[model samples]
Target: MIQMPLQDMIKKITDGAGISEQEVNDKIKQKLEQLSGLISKEGAAHIISNELGVKLIPETTGRLEIKNILMGMRDVEVVGKVTHNFGIREFKTDNREGKVANIIIADETGSIRIVCWGDQADKTSDLNPGDIVKISSGYVRSNQERNEIHMNDRSVLEKNPEGITIDIGPSAASRKKIEELAENEGNAELLGTIVQVFDPKFFEVCPECNKRAKPTESGAYSCPQHGDVTPNYSYLLTAYLDDGTGNIQAVFFRNLVESLLGKNAEEILSYKDNPSAIEQIKTDLLGNMIKVTGRVNKNTMFERLEFVVQSVDPNPNPDDELKLLEKEKQSVEAQAVTEEVQ
Candidate 1:
């Protein structure tokens, strides 16, 4: 990671704040010495930048490819095409409710998910599939076995910006059957019929980080990352899906649930308080065929194989697949008859 020179950073801060260069340098030196063994020179420079209200982006480092990104990197720039965009969901903290959006962007090298929070989430409302974008000053972190980029207040999001063109290769997901699903199979597409829609459950989430908020002994909700949150509601749906050969439990989050039930979390939560409304939603979804794309994992809590659905297509055509199966079955029956006669 390239860093701005101390002299150049000091000059910028002094000029921007109408302060003497000597005073700025002394302040930076004092901060560095105070935390002598704790932070590096680059970290000290970052502290100085924040203190002086200066945003730092290395001019010489250039844009990083998605393949080169590592966890804990900051102020990185990358350009890619939006391959998948998820619905914005709301969460509440002690202060108020906030929204978050997530999307998967891909370049020729690979793909990574970008999480946008608060007003930044609204900025992604106009983004569409295949749209080129440039993200600047973004933060990178790894979560749930995958690396993701986060756009915060300090980040910049540009759509179809000049001097950037990413070759977004095929984004189609590989199809797998329920019987063939293995633990940690990454992302895959599956076709199956919903055997049952279990009663949906709602949980409280922290508004700041969008993590689940656990209840405290004092009758308040708290998040590990963001303490003392007011708690916002989010829905989770578990259903059994069968693809002829086998069956597996599938879990659906807010976006997938809305897509499948045609209702958002708020609407779903309203129904949760009414038994008839909840049953109606179950009645409308059970026994329906769907094409699901998601990550396969082992549910350690339940000791069963589970699919965490990313998206759901409630209207999938299974006629062609059934025809092929019938044709193969007929061929096998004819061979069996010939063998019996012989």
Candidate 2:
């Protein structure tokens, strides 16, 4: 069974059924009343999708394009040219240890993050830039708001696969002002100043799988797959970024967290034991200019929109900023003139 976020499910339904989001919500509410609130909103939406003849998952036998792959899809297959290799990271848990490899691949449509785990990660070492790879039996997972094709134990990885060629292109992210960002918009680039920064929050996860672990009946935390284990710690950092147009809430995960703070993983994770250690870092980030590319997600729990950053550049080119400034100025002047003519 495919488990996707409720908002994402609603998005697919509204797009497929040619209906407004409000109409879909009204129907879901009606369904809840009819069923005495027995079923979940997601289940109601799924039923509505089926009744409208809107298929949530595409039915096909061939490989999919990167753009067509959605979060929560399973048994996915895609072939693309490897654009970059991020190298492999190894982690250990009480029960087992494994490696994770992150690679960026692109097709004519767009690029995506392919995360290989365990044995599949080893295969990535043989891959190089411009090499073609075919991924089979992969699962699509949403990290923050971006969809990544994850290959686990049941997945297949083929390097320099025959009969495969992809016309790779530059990243498809749209460079937009903070004010111009829209919910569900993926691969967006924002150049802005750090208006505000929050103290980092640390959390525990299963080291082997890197999923959230919870307390068991006993005192120790346990992973559903890894059983009772010593958990590894990770941190989350959030800040408000402002370009001249507006400000947006931006979130940075583990990999980019170190880059943002100019600290190594150990130094950042050390804050878990001493919570007060991050005050200096938090103070340093304020008022700094940075460039970020990420996906904008409607933060349902917080009831606001947020940018889940995938990449960060602490020092961006000033010339590029000047060009954008001029472009924005012209756009504003053109808009004012059009308004006057109207």
Q: Of the candidates shown, which would achieve the greatest lDDT relative to the real structure?
A: 2
lDDT of 2 by residue, 281-332 (tens): 7888889999999988778688789999999999999998899879989999
lDDT of each: 0.81, 0.87
Q: Per-prediction TM-score, please?
A: 0.46, 0.53
lDDT of 1 by residue, 270-297 (tens): 8667757788779877789888998777
lDDT of 1 at 231: 89
Worst 10 residues of 2 by lDDT: 163-172
Q: Which stretches of candidate 1 lie over 4 Å from their true place?
A: 1-171, 317-342
Best by TM-score: 2
Ten contiguous residues with the weakest lDDT in model 1: 53-62
